[model samples]
Target: MSSNRVTPTEAWQATASRAADCALFFDFDGVLSPITDDPEASQPVPEVLEALDALSRLVRRVAIVSARPVDFLRARFGTLSEVDLFGLYGLERSHGKGETVTEPAALPWVPVVEEVASEARTALGDKAYVEFKRLSVALHWRKTPEHAAEIESWAHAEAERRGLKVQLGRKVIELKPPVDRDKGFVISEAVLSVGCAWYFGDDVSDIKAFDALRARTAVEPGFLGVCVAVASSDETGQEVSDAADFTIESPVAVGTFLADAVKILQANAAS
Candidate 1:
């Protein structure tokens, strides 16, 4: 809602008008689906699928960069086509044909993550909750605010012991493999391979992608890229919005924005 920031609707319109040579990136959890207590339970808004289908036809490339595992995301959106999917915060990339590219060094981290989850469950006891992601383990302190400090300490200690990295967002802390790759790195690589790019995200983790876009624009004129945040009354959402070029009210708004972008691109193409 800053003076210089655009609304999701307006940003989508601008993106659609210049769809050619554009690469679109999306964050799955909060941007495509409403965040839930159980991350695995998150489901994309119905319209998002339709809009992605349309947008794929308009843009040069569309990719999803998420912290979820590639296999999980593929299973979730198995029917969609022409949209590239990157999971584990871009540590893994997969296409529709089931071909997957992953950092070989990070492959061993899966079992490490599982071990951490077990450790968290044992360490936290009944005070905190653990969500086991294939590539990472998230410790949720939403239901145990009194144990936030303890949870953070445990997460840090476990990550250090495993020689991994920790990412803090909202009321959750995640342990990811120690790699120099992230959504930003993925976006930058994608742009180099493709061209202009745009990104939509809804959490602090997505800030990396936003920063990447800003950095790219500074070096290249008319980059035709923007970062959008899906705003919510939560710390993670606020952090993401602060770094974004535009903010949408909710997941529903995000779907509407995507749908509008597809319409604009289609209309422009027809004209």
Candidate 2:
């Protein structure tokens, strides 16, 4: 095991020598874009997009696993034809060519999420706000810190009533159907089907991917996996950093990391 923390530049240089054995994955919202007051309007940092485009040529597979709807992420970075997009924590998948493949069972969960969001809004009142993501719904209390406890209670109770699962993220609580899917599960499946994997993320939800990477390595010797946590000053960011194998300062750092990886891969291919 490597104990020294490598910067994005160093990490890429190391991987360039073993390009064929690596796969890169990222969490979209916080990893690629700065968290915004309005989740619906979040966009990736300019450098992040450019880096992803460059990295696409280096590794065998580069993907994004996120809680956002597939279409939403596709709209943001779909212009690049070399990256794969996985949304809803792997419940949905979109290819680089703009084609999407989704789990059939996940489709029906949409209306259930809508109903839950409506009920949550009425129950929580103005103390909390609701974000209706296409596949999931989030109740945010960042602006109303006092309502965190109340929001959590309501989310748990409401999710139970609807037979759905509630995920705690940052200062928000999300409701999604209890699917046999998660970021970790997705990463494992991707690795088995594609060789080795790397994941970058910035939230507690991403811990599932980190755990998955550890588990896979334990069972299979010589498996190449990299778990990265993008850092911020928030509690959620701290949690993710603790769970990750390495930490990067911000989204720009992530972009620089990806771009460097691409360069290494290209140089190796030419050599």
Candidate 3:
């Protein structure tokens, strides 16, 4: 772990004291579940969601912020009253798992994004299908890792041509509207009501959330803001780890951390 990050013991110590007032934020893929080549195939670890259900009963708030769409998120998470799923970063939000609110500012970009997805599918064929997202398009090359560079380059050029933004992730490249919204915005908005905010994530987009936590902690010196990186075997995890205040080994470790957190929170509540 880097000097900036606390060990698990230290993280527990720091969080335990403030658990009652803390808000927990997590990224979906790679954090709650392992990444899948088919985004549609990704599902939360059963233990993970069950742990979240347990923790949510004790915590002030629990949120899952991710690049996945709200519909997919709602389907997988399924009416978990304790969790808020913010999809496509902050462009859409599902509160109490009831209804998702899509930002109106993002509405105008839908047609353009759809057009980009269509073009990408026609050009890349089955290799990069499922390019149509109302707010973004993703070209997954997880199965074809050898073509990563090729796909990335092409995606970048296409994004530039179409005035869109591209995000790099594990075995995937996403082209989204060039909106100001991101995981950072979601965290920044979330931290205002909570005393201590902890965010766990595992990708380039999560870096924005880490930076937000770091920034909010600076101004609100009393805020216990923690950034946890749920890493994979790849280098992408290293980048996320470098920016994190703590790092967990893998999604399984995230479950362990969450379980421990639940115990600590419950213990503190009892005491």
Candidate 4:
């Protein structure tokens, strides 16, 4: 927890007090799903999903903004139609089971992204796991931590050559189209009309979202922006914790925290 630490109940009460005008945003990995070596195998804790199901109805809106593609997020959250999905760091969006909409600017880069992924797979080989998203490519060195520096250097060089954007994460580097879109851009736009908003995230990339909230709070009178970091042993977790308003232990704690938030919101409504 940072100096801004507030009890879970206090945090919930503040947001629940303005539930009608409040919006909630979350990052899928680490915050909702446990981090795993195999990215494809990660699954969100059912308890968290259960809580989100309730939270969506209580709040003005609920959304998951992630680096994964909207198709991937939709597969995981298809039933939660009330929850909006923003994937590929805001390049994609799906509103409440609606069509997955891609930013027009990014559509032209699909071929380039595919080419990059192919080149990365051949160049990196068994040294890294190359993930191919339609609009981006991510190289993961988690299993072979010793190759982190090598992977990072190669990713940066690739980005420079291809005019792509490089996103660094926990033992991973992603190359995407050079569009000026990111987690911060997503949050800043989403909260424009919101009176109170809370964003939960767990990686270094998530820091942008926290920064977005702080920036908004600074300029918007009577607006509340809560940043909750999910703690882990990884250095990114520490960085996120430092930037966050408070810290929750892990994805398990996130489930409990959301459940508790639901209870507080209900009680406040009844009162």
lDDT (tens digit, per residue) of candidate 2 on 1-271? 2327565556566677777767888998778988777788889888888878877766777798988888889889878898888888787898886778888887899899998888888999888889887678989987898989999998998888889888888888888878888898898788875546778888888989888888888888677667888884365556677787778787877777666666677887898
Return model 2's CA RMSD, one decimal: 1.9
Q: Across residues 105-205, which tens digit of lDDT does each residue of candidate 4 receive?
A: 99999999999999988998989999999999999998999999999999999899999999999889999998999999999999998999999998989
Computed on alpha carbons, the lDDT of every model, listed in order, comes to 0.80, 0.81, 0.81, 0.90
List the candidates' TM-scores in order.
Answer: 0.91, 0.92, 0.93, 0.97
Residue pairs clashing in model 4 are none
Off by over 4 Å in 1: 1-14
lDDT computed for candidate 4: 0.90
Question: In what order do the candidates fall by TM-score, top score first?
Answer: 4, 3, 2, 1
| Model 3 steric clash pairs | none
Pairs that collide in candidate 2 are none
Instruction: List ranges where model 3 is wrong by over 4 Å.
Output: 1-6
> Higher-TM-score candidate among 1 and 2?
2
Could you tell me the lDDT of residue 31 within candidate 1?
A: 79
C-alpha RMSD between model 3 and the true structure? 2.0
Which window of 10 residues has the lowest lDDT sum in candidate 4? 1-10
